[model samples]
Target chain A: MGESLRIYAKLVGAQGRAQASYRTSFWLDLIGSSIIVGADLIAVLVIFSRVPALGGFSISQTLVFFGIALTAFSIADLVVGNIERMRNYVRMGTLDAMLIRPLGVLPQLLANDVGFRRAGRVVYAGAVYVVALSYADIDWTPGRVVLVVSAPLFGAVFFAAFFVATATVAIWWVESGELANALTYGGRDLTSYPISIYGGWFRRMFAFGLGFAFVAYYPGLALLGDPDPLGGPAWLGWASPLVGIAASGVAALIWRTGVRHYRSTGS
Target chain B: MGLVTATTDRVTIRNFAEFASLIGAIAASGFRRFWTYRQATVAALATNTMFGFLRTYVMLAMAALTPVVAGYTGPQLAAYVWTGQGLLGVVMLWGYADLADRIRSGDVVTDLLRPIHPVLNYLAVDLGRAAHGMIFRFLPPVAVGVIVFDMYLPQDLSTYPLFAISVLLAVIVCFACRYLVNASAFWLLDHRGVVMVWLFVSGLFGGLYFPIRFLPQWAALLIWLGTPGPSMLQAPMDIFVERDPFRVQLAIVGVQVFWAVLMLWACHVVQRRAERKMVIQGG
Candidate 1:
């Protein structure tokens, strides 16, 4: 484990240096990414102006949901940047280098790429989160604050799981990973808004057995003291992070299966 | 005149069984190439579901304040969101990056020299990918929308044909827009920055994230008249959902035809100019 951790650190360090080489491109991407977050935020603000409340939740309350979701997504992006770029590694046959290493394949894969550019997103998510909290009724209770602050930890797990699951498919079809990108990147963009605005089965699937509802909706309900829009018991909201953890765990299992399939198929 | 020639050739080919068979065979191979990426299909479906969920919630929340916000009810809004998300998978094209890569790698020369038409081949691959997305990426979300929201379907069954035509035109318009943007890479080293700006603009104007109806009157009108984004997703969604068969169909196909002619013409001029520039620059 220690050897793997060391290798992981070194891999990420190298990626950071390499990315830093393109300083102008890096900053341009940063500005562009921040603008994306800003644009979404603007959209939400526009919607709120026209309507008094969203499903009994005020704009301030909705902002909390966005804040937590955005922070979680940003952190997830930071950690899973390497795993998500697995398509490139697979296509380039760079997976062979990791396979030959003494460390486990997952760690090397997880540590291979570091996106310094995503730091801009992280900062933006944080800044927006802080601004949202300042205006929100967020109770000053220690436990409440802790729950709110820790939302992203689990959110990251879930999102990274989604990434891993998508990346694992690279074993079968390296070029088609853009479909996964359309999902992950697009999904992140969608989550900033209130989940209730989505179509029906999509909401039910994510909220229930699929476990994505835990990412923001359920947690936000608990944090904000809002009732379940789906008419379920209130306790489910507090337990949404578990959904993220479970999702990541499931993704890890799927990744292992995908690897086995890849080895056997020689794809 | 060019379209007439193209249509006549297509009619002639369709009239011949052997030619149709060959086209079918080539299309099948193309389908197989894309279907092999089954994992991507599943992942994209999952992600689309998640996006659909969020949008549904936002719209539902809005409806809670008022039963009908804009022209759509809560359920209709749900349908709109799911349909829009699903459409992104089917209609959105990565043409710019693909074109940029070809140009930067100097593979455009080979593409230009191919015995078959480069544009036709690209269109074939795009259609195959769109079919795959429509099945794997689109149908799932739409199906889920039906079950969850009890969403309404097209009331007039006859309108379905027009919906199909509108969808096809929407896809064509989307492709033309992407192709035109990508052709810029022939001169520029990197079109990604410009493409991102274009995509962001489309999200606002094209009604990808939210319908243009929600935009202020003047802004929405400007988007409709100035950019091709609304014709791609918004107009089709409106036609299919609102059952305004005549107007939506006309808007979609009309704009698509306009853009297709414009883009093909632009491509011709740009290709000529690019060739001259390349010759002078020794590229």
Candidate 2:
């Protein structure tokens, strides 16, 4: 484990230096991503400006979900996004080289192109989160504090699992980018709003079927100490962190199966 | 008329006609380029369809909050979402940094040396792409929307012609705005940043998000961003929903036309200036 950690640090350090070489591009990327967050924030602000609430949640409350979702997704994207390149690597027959490496295939891929450009999203998400907490009007309690603090941590795990599992799917179907987007980008967009606002089928598919609801919505309810407006116990919100663990386990199994399939087929 | 002057006049008319035909050919080629990309168009259509449903729900949900928010009735809001999805690709209302890439690769010099006006040629290509987008990208999404959401259309035959005219103008304005964004690459060198910002704000001001009218605070500000931004997607769309009176809708088209002219003029000026300052970087 110590050796693995050292290798990762070295790889990331090298990658960071390369990225730092393009000073202007680096700044532009940061600002470019921040603009996306800015646009979403504007949409939310505009909608709330006309409506008192959406799905029985106030604008401030909605921000808590948005904040958690964005931050968590940002964390997941910055790290596991490299895994998505597995498609191209596989197609180019580069996996043969990776398979020969003494270090694990997952770590090498994870450390291949680590970048800080996602910090742009982090900046905006952090800002929105801070603003949300300020206006959240929640009673201060230790349990709530811990939940709020850990929300992004759990959400990141949940999202990272989504990315890894989706990337694993790329081993079988190289054209899985769009299908994968249904969970990654699509799921992120879905989580930005209160799930109760969505229709019954839409709610069922994303919330319960995919378990993405654990990433932000359920966790958000837990932090707010609010009941689930979608006819479920409010405490269902606390299940996200556990769901994140479960997702990671499933993602691992899928990744192993994919690797085994690749080796057996020797493609 | 003198023999030389008469000959010159004849030559000038012939040249103008030839140029028009050249542009038409380029436009056709542009159309074919988009049509050829069958998979990309389908993939993009799928994404747009997905967003169409999401936005429809979001818009209707917002409309449900108030019987009317910013003069958009629930049906009107639904119309806006579905039609916006159709027009999204048709307008290509996003940053186009192709000129920046050309500049980076030194290919822009070839364009500069061409006898044709660079802006006009690019406009031809874009118009062709827009036509292709309308046929392939716009129709599929709208058909789905009509089936699923009961999207609105004008009852009057007159409205169709006017809407068509508005859509054409919007396409022109969209092209001009994108051209201008690309032109800035000559000066900025790193045009992606500029293009990114343009695309990000255009959706807000361009009515890809909620209607600009919903943004009372920002409506004046958006209008002040000058003509092309609002004239492109937002105005044509406002006309589509029949949210405005006929004359008012005609006036929106008028805004689009006026901006299209101004923006086209602006593109020519930028191309001329870029040629003057021709600095080739990292070919």
Candidate 3:
């Protein structure tokens, strides 16, 4: 395990150096990536303008939802953004390059690019979260404070798992990148708003079928002290960290299955 | 003297024929190139269609909250969401770096050294791409939309021609701005950063998320400063919805025309400077 970590570190360092090689481009991408905030802003503003609240949460509360979602996704993007490139590697038969390496394919794949460029999104999300924290109007409690502080870590791991699982599926069918996007990007969009705003089928599919709601929604409910409009217990929000662990486990299992299948098929 | 004039006239006619054929070949090739990526086109269409569903619902919900939110009713909002996706492909803004790659590889020198204009070449290709996208990528989302919600066709007979003109002008404006972005490759080591900045701001100011009307009033006003942000994707979609009066539609189209001309002029100026300062350092 230590050896695998060391190898991962080395690969990450190489990618970091390669990215840092272009100083201006790196900075530009970091700042430019934050522009997605505009889209989010538009959604929030347009929805709230007609009404003061959505799904019993105020505009500031929805902003917190977006902030938490953005923070976690940005952290995931920084570490495992290269998972999105798995389609190319699989289609081009370049997965063999990593397979031939002495390192475990998972570690190498996880460390593939370690997108430093996403630093912009991280900083941007952090700033937005700070704004949300001030505006949410929630009472301060020790346990809640802990969850708020550590929310990003849980979010990062949960989303990293999502990205890995998405990439794993690419090994079988490379053309399903858009479908994968419908999950990751769609999930991000889903979680960034009030859960009750979605249709019944969508809410059920995300909560029970894909299990994306555990990654953010229930935990956000706990943080906000709001009851789950979908009839889940509000106390289930404390499971944020647990959800991260479960996501990691599921991702690991999916990845192992995909790798085994690839070895057997040699495709 | 008569013989000289006759020969000159013959040569001029032949040159015109050659130029027209060149543009035709480039445009045709551009159209055919997209066919090779049928999977990508299908995937993009699927994604757009899904987003249309999600966005329409959101807009409808917003309308429920307030009877007339952002000058759109429920059915109009559905039509807006679906048609907006199609318009996105037709205008088709992206951050590509063909010129940067050429410049980096020292191939741009030869490209510039060609007798024909480079910006015009790219514009021709883009026109062909827009045509292809309109056929395959644009209409499918709207087709999917019809089943989900009733569409709003404008009561005015002239809105169709006006909308078509608005769309054509917007595509020109989009391509022109992109040309200027690509032109930056001549001076900067990494113009990709600039392209990202362009995309970032454009995604917001271009009114992709919602109409520019929804922006904080200050941002809405500031959207028109130096760049032609709204003219790209927003103007055409807004025109199709017929949210504005005839005079307002005319004004919006006028703005699009102005931006298209301004961006094209900037491309010409930048190319001239880039050629003057041409330096081929390494491959």
lDDT of each: 0.71, 0.78, 0.76
Regions more than 4 Å wrong, model 3: A35-39, A42-50, A175-179, A239-246, A263-267, B1-21, B113-115, B150-155, B216-226, B279-283
Residues B1-283, candidate 1: write the lDDT tens digits. 1222111222223345755555566556656876986766676676677667667777777877888776777777887888887888777744336666777887776555443445655655666666666677677899988977657677777557876666666676776677667778876666656676776776776786667777777877788777777877777677667634466557656775676566656666776677667656665
lDDT of 2 by residue, A1-267 (tens): 998889889998999889889899888988887786687788889889889988788898999899999888888888786786887777677887888888888988888887578777877787888888788887778878888878888888989998899888767865444556657776777788888777767678767887878888887888777888777787777788888899999999999999888842345
lDDT of 3 by residue, B1-283 (tens): 1222111221233477888888888888878887676877887787787677667767766766777666767677777788788877787877346677887787776565444677877878888888898889778998888866666656788888988898888888888877788888877777766777777767667877677776566766578544588888888777888888899889889888889988888887887677666633221
- Report residue A151 deviation for candidate 1 (angstroms): 2.7
| Clashes per candidate (backbone, < 3 Å) | 12, 1, 0
- TM value for model 3: 0.89
Q: Assess the local accuracy of residue B279 in candidate 2 as a C-alpha lDDT between 0 and 100.
A: 38
Per-candidate DockQ versus the true complex? 0.32, 0.45, 0.53
**Model 2 DockQ vs. reference:** 0.45
Q: What is residue B63's positional error in candidate 1, in angstroms? A: 3.5
Worst 10 residues of 3 chain B by lDDT: B1-10
TM-score, chain A, candidate 3: 0.92
Per-prediction TM-score:
0.80, 0.89, 0.89
Native-referenced DockQ of model 1:
0.32
lDDT of 3 at A72: 87
Could you give the TM-score of chain B for each candidate, in order?
Answer: 0.84, 0.89, 0.87
Off by over 4 Å in 1: A1-7, A87-93, A169-205, A208-214, A217-267, B1-50, B94-96, B114-144, B243-256
